[model samples]
Target: MARDPFATADLEIVGQVTTASNVTLVCGADGVRVVYKPVRGERPLWDFPDGTLAGREVASYLVSDALGWGLIPETILRDGPVGPGMVQRWIEQVRQPVGRPELVDLCPVGEIPEGFREVLRALDGGGRPVSLIHADDPRLRRMAVLDVLLNNADRKGGHALDGADGRVYGVDHGICLHTEPKLRTVLWGWAGEPVEDELLSDITLFVKALPGELGDRLAELITDTEIDALETRGRALLDNPVLPLPQGTRPIPWPAF
Candidate 1:
C-alpha cells in the first residue's frame, strides 16, 4: 500500500535529471517513490518567494480536487528525510507510441492532434452546467483559462498528464498566481470561433460560485486583485463580447490529448 514519508534506508537514490526542475528520485520501496528537492538551489525568479513551489504544488492539487478533476497527480506534503517535500503518485510508463512533448502556450495553430481535439470536446462541459474538471487534462481550456488568470507559467506538456484509461492529467503548478493577463498558452486553435453560449454561462456560474468555495483558498495563495480579475474575466466570457481572447495560446497542443 502507499505510505507516508518516512526515514528509511529502503529509499534507493536514483540518478538526477534537469528536465523541469532538478529532482532526485528514490526507488524500490513497497508501493513508494520519493522525489527530493535540493537545498542548494537554482537561480530563482524574484516574483515568487523561495521555497514556495511546494506550497503551489499543494494548492494546485487542492484546486484540482475542488473541480473534481482527476488529471492532477495525487500529492501530499510530508516530512521527508531532508526537510519538507511533496510525495506524488508514482507513474510507470511503458513504451507506447505517443506524440512528442509540446507546450500548450507555444502550440502552432495547425499542429493540434486529433486526441487533443477529443479531450477539448470532453472538457467543453457542453450546454448542461458549469462543473469542475481535473487539472491533469491536457485539453483543459478551463484550466488554461484559470492558469492564465493565475499566471501559471509552468503548464508544460509533460506536466499535463495522460492518464491510464486515456485521460489527461496536469502537474507542476509552482509559478501560478499573478495580476497580469498572463494568457499565453498554445491550446486555442478556435480563437476565431464564437464562444458557445452554454459554456459561457457555465463559466459565469462557476466564477460566481468561486467566492464561496474557492475564495478562502484563493485569498490565502493569491492577492485580492487577482481574484477580482478572475471574476471579471468569467463575467466577460459570459457576456460573450468581441473582446481580445488570450493570444498565443491555442486550445490544443500537438500530442497534448
Candidate 2:
C-alpha cells in the first residue's frame, strides 16, 4: 500500500494557536504548512466524547470534498508529534482592502451594505447600535448548506476564511456530525430562501453517494447513527430545498467572531 504524503511527512511544530480552545499547533509537514490538533489535547465536552473531535474534523472534510464544494481544506487523520490527530492544510487568508466589509461583520443599523444581509441587531460594547451581517455570496451559501448537513454545532465568524487562492474555506469543525441536531452558525443570511438549483443538484448526488463509498469512509470517522442522521439531513434539504431559519434561542454561537 502507498502512504499519503500529507499523513506520512515529518511534522515540525512552528507555533501554537493560543486563542484556540484546544491545543492547536501550527506545523510544517515537509514543505506543507498545516494545523495539527492532537486528540490528547482535545478538551472533553459534555456532549461529545473525548478523542473523537479529531475524527469529526476529518469527517467534515470528507463530506465537504464529496460535495465538491471545497468548503474545507484538505484534512487527514494521522500521527503527529503529540500522537494521532487531525492535520489540515493551512489556509492563508487574503487581506481585504481597507473599508471593505468582511464575509461576516458588523455594520451600523440601517446602513447595511448592498450585498449583505443582516442576521442580528444589537448594541455594541460602546452602546452603539449595529447589525451582524454576512455577504450574499454563493460560496458562503454553499458553506451554510454544508453546515446544515454536518449539523455543525459551532460555526463562529472566525471560522470562515477568505483564502489567498480566492476561495472561501471553513475551519475548526471538531464539534460536528452528531446524531442530535446542533446547527449553530453565523450564516443565517439566506434563511428561508430557496436553495439554488445547482447546489441542490450537487446535494442530490451527495445523498446518493452516502450509502456507498462516502458512507464507508464516514463510518470509520463517525458512528453509524451520525451517518444516518447526515443522510436524513441531506434528504430533508432536497425535499425542502430552502435554507432554514434560525431556530431555538442559540442558533448563532456566542462571541461569534
Candidate 3:
C-alpha cells in the first residue's frame, strides 16, 4: 500500500497531552509541529467504540475541508511511532487556564458581557455560580456552525482556540459524527440568529457534495450509518439556516472548558 505524506515521517515527541483519553503527543516531524494520537494508545470510552477515536479525528478534518471552512487543522490518518493513528497540524496559541481569570473571557455566564454568549451555567466545587461564555467573533461563529454540522458532542471552551494565523480553530473532535443528535458546545451565542448568507452558501455546497464526495472518504473512518446521520444533519442545517435552539436535558459539556 502506498503511504500518505505523514505515514513514514520521522516523529519526535515534544510533549504529552495529559487530559486526553488517548496518549496524545505533541511531536516535531521534519521540523513541523504536529499532534500524534496513536490508535494503540487509546483508552476505551463507553459511548464511542474502542480504538476508533483517531479515525473520528481525521473524519472531522475531512468534513471541515469539504465545507471549505477550515475550522479544523490539517489532519491525516497514518502510522505513528506506536501504530497507525491520526496526525494533525499543531495549532500555536497562547495557552490560558480553563477556569479562573480567563474563564470570563473564554466562557462566561449570567449578566453576559456585551460581546459574549452565555452557553450554559454550572456550580463550582464550592457551589459557586459559573457561566460558560464564548467570544462573539465571526470566526468562532463559523466554528459553531461547523460544530452543528458535525453533530459535535464535545465543544468545550478550551477546544476552540485563537491560532497564530489569527483564525479560530477547533480541536478534540474524536466524539463527533455520531448517529444521534449530539450537538453539545459552548457556542450558543448565535442561537436563534440567522446564519450569514456566506455561511449558508457554504453549507449549501457541503450538503450537495457530502453524499458523493465526502461521504466516500468518511465511510472508511466511521460507520455507514454515521455517514447517513451526517447527511441528515447537513440537510437539517440547510433547511433551517439558522443557529438552533438548544434541545434535550444537557446541551453543553461538563467543565464547559
Candidate 4:
C-alpha cells in the first residue's frame, strides 16, 4: 500500500490553535489539510498520564475507523514541524444557517421547540431558565454513539460540528480511552434510549476485528490495559446497547458550548 500522505509529508506550522492544549498547523500540501498537536506542547493534566494525550488522540481515530463511524477526521501520529505529535485532517465546517437563534446560544427553557431534547438547564445571568438543546440530526446521533464507545471524557457542544458535506464531525478527543468509565458529554438527548440496530451492527463488527489489526494499531498508542478496557466496554454495549446514563454528579462539561 502507498504510504499515507499525512505521515510522510513535510509539516510546517502555519499558526496555533488557541483553544487546544498543544495544537498547531501543517501548511496544507498535496490537498492534505491537517492540525498538528505536538507532544512537547501538551499541557499536563493531573488525572491523565503525562505526555500521552497525543497518543490518545491517535487512538481515538483508530477506534473511530474500526467502528466505521467516520465521526473523527483522519488522524495519525507522525513527526510534525515541531516534533512527533497527532496530525488530524482539518474539517471544513459548513456555514451554519442564520436566523436560528438557538443554533449557537442558550435558548430560554420555555422557548425550545418540540422535537429538540434538552441536555442542559441553568440559571442565566438574568436568573432565567437557560436550556441547551441537542438537534435531532442523524449525524449528531452517530457522533454520540462514537463518544460512548471511546469513553470520551469531553464532548462539549462545540466539539461536534457540521462538516461541509452535511455530516457531523467530532474532534478534540485528547482525553479519551480512560481505563475507568468517564463518559462526559453534552449529547444526553438519548440518555436512556436503546442503541440503533445500525450502530450496534457497527460495534459488533468492530469487536470482531479487535483481536487482530485494530488491536495492534491501538497498542501502539495506548496501554494494553486501556485496550482491554475498551474491549470490555464494547462487549458490554453489545449485550445492552443503550446510551449509558450519566455517571458522577456532573456529567456535562462546563461552559457546554
Candidate 5:
C-alpha cells in the first residue's frame, strides 16, 4: 500500500480552537486541512488515563472504517509539529438554511417537525420552554449505532457534522472506548427503536472482525481490557439490536453543542 502524504507532510498551524477543552489546532499540510490534538495538550481526566485521548480518537476512526460506515473522517495517530497527536481530515460542513436544523437542534416545545424526534424538553436562557431534537435520517441513525459500538462518552450535537459531500461525519472522539459504560450523547431520538437490518448485519461482521487486524490496531492504542469491552458492547448490540434509552442522570452532554 502507498504511504499517506498527509501523515508525512509538515503541518502548519493556522488557528486554535479556543472553545475546546484541550489544545486543538487547525493546520494545513500540502493543501489538506486537518485538526491536530496533541497528546501533551490533553487535559487530565480522572476517568481516562493521561495522554491516551489522541489514540482513542484514532481508534474510533478505525472502528468506523471497519464497520464501513465512513461516519468518521480519515484519522491517524502521528507525530505532529508539537508532538504525537491525533490528526484527522477536517470536514467542511454544509450550511443549513435559516430556521433549519442540521442533525440536532432546538425548537419550541411541542412543535417538533415531521421526521424529527424529540429528546428532551428544557428551559432556554430566556426562560422559554424548548425541546432538543434530532433528525430521523438514516445517516444519523448509523452514527447513533456507531456511538453505541464505540461506547462513545461524548457525542455532542456539534460533533455530528453535515458535510458538504452530503454525508454525516462524527468527530471529537477522544473520550470514547472506555472499559466502563460511559455512553453519553444527544442521539437518544432513536431510543427503543429497532436498528435497521443492514446496520445490524454490518455490526455482526464487525464483531467477528474484532479479534483480528482491527483488534490488533486498537490494541496498540487502547488497553486490552478496553478492546474487550468494545467487543462485548458490539456483541450485546447484536443480541438486542435496539437503540437503548438514556441511563443515569446525565445522558446528554451539557451545553448540547
Candidate 6:
C-alpha cells in the first residue's frame, strides 16, 4: 500500500506512550487523539510501514463500526512524519474503580474491574440483536469482544482504558485480528459460556448493515481473504451459544489495576 505522507507539524503530540516503539500520543488538526508512528530508514516493525499500518487501522475501524459503538475511534488519517498513521478517539480514563481491583490484579483482563458482574448485568442488549451473546450498548461490548477476537496481545490492563465518557476503549493494534484463534487474552475464562441474547441480535444487525463502498475502501489496505475472514468471524459470533458461565470464569478481561 502507498503511504500518505505528512509533515510532523500536522499533529499535536500530547503525552508519552511506551510499550510500543516510536509511539507518541498526538492530537491531529481535527482534534483527535492518535498515536504517531514515525517511519524512517529501518525495518518495517521498527521504523514504520506507513500506509500498511494506516490501512490495517482502517480495517479495524470498519469492523468496529460493524460491531457497533464498542469498537470506536475517530478515524484513520494519513498524518505522520513519513505517512498516514492511525488516528483514534481518546477515551477519558475511568476515575473510580467500579469493581474489585484484587481479582483483576491476580489475573489480567485489560484493566477491567473484577466483580463487574452487576455492571454487566445492568447493560442493555442492543435491540437490533443477533443470535449469540451481546451487550445492551452494542458499542461498548463491541470493543471488548473485538479486542478478544482480534487477540490484541497488548490489551493489558492499561491498554483497556476507561474512557470516563460512559464508554471503554482499546488501543495498540500492533498485534490484533490475526488469521489464527491467537486468543491470548484476559477474557478467556469465559469461553464456552452463554453469550448475551441482545448482544447476539446486535451482531446480526451489524453485519447486515455493512456498506458496499467499504469493500472498495478496504481493498486498498487488506486482502480479500482478510475481509472474508472477518465476515466469517462475525457470523460465528452471532451463532455462538449462550451457556451459563462456569465457576471461576470471566467472559472479558479483568482490569489489571
Error of 1 at 21 (Å): 3.4
Question: Predictions ranked by TM-score, top down?
Answer: 5, 2, 4, 3, 6, 1
Alpha-carbon runs more than 4 Å astray in model 5 = 1-3
| Clashing residue pairs in candidate 2 (N, C-alpha, C atoms within 3 angstroms) | none
Candidate 1 lDDT by residue in tens digits, 1-257: 64443434244445444554545444433446645443233336677653456655655666556545454667555544455555566554333456443323222334454334312332222453222112323346555544543456555456654555555556666666555555444344344345545445555556767788677876665567756766776566656633244455553333332
lDDT of 6 by residue, 1-257 (tens): 53332322366666656544445455554444555554331125532323465556666676666666554554565555455566665566756556434211332323333333222322123443211121233344445567644545444545555566766666656545555444434433344555677667766775665446666666676666655666666677777643223233443433322
Worst 10 residues of 6 by lDDT: 128-137
The per-residue C-alpha lDDT of model 4 at residue 255 equals: 64
In model 1, the worst 10-residue window by lDDT is: 129-138
Candidate 4 lDDT over 147-199, as tens digits, reads 88889999888888778886778888999998888888988888888889998
lDDT of 5 by residue, 28-108 (tens): 988889999999999889999733899999999999999999999999988888999999999999999987877899999
Full-model lDDT for every candidate: 0.50, 0.92, 0.81, 0.81, 0.92, 0.50
CA lDDT of 244 in candidate 3? 89
Which segments of model 1 are wrong by more than 4 Å? 1-15, 22-30, 34-43, 49-51, 92-95, 98-146, 192-205, 241-257
Question: After superposing candidate 2, which stretches have Cα over 4 Å from the reference?
Answer: 1-5
What would the C-alpha RMSD of candidate 3 be, to one decimal place? 3.3
Q: Can you write out model 3's per-residue Cα lDDT over 91-127, one digit (the tens) per residue?
A: 9885555543332243233566666766667766677
lDDT of 2 by residue, 1-257 (tens): 96665778899999999999999999997788999999999999999873389999999999999989999999998899999999999999989899899999999999998999899999999999999999888899899999999999999999999999999999999999988878999999889999889989999999999999899999898998888989999999999999898889899988898
- Model 1 TM-score is 0.61
Which runs of model 3 end up more than 4 angstroms from their true locations?
1-8, 95-112
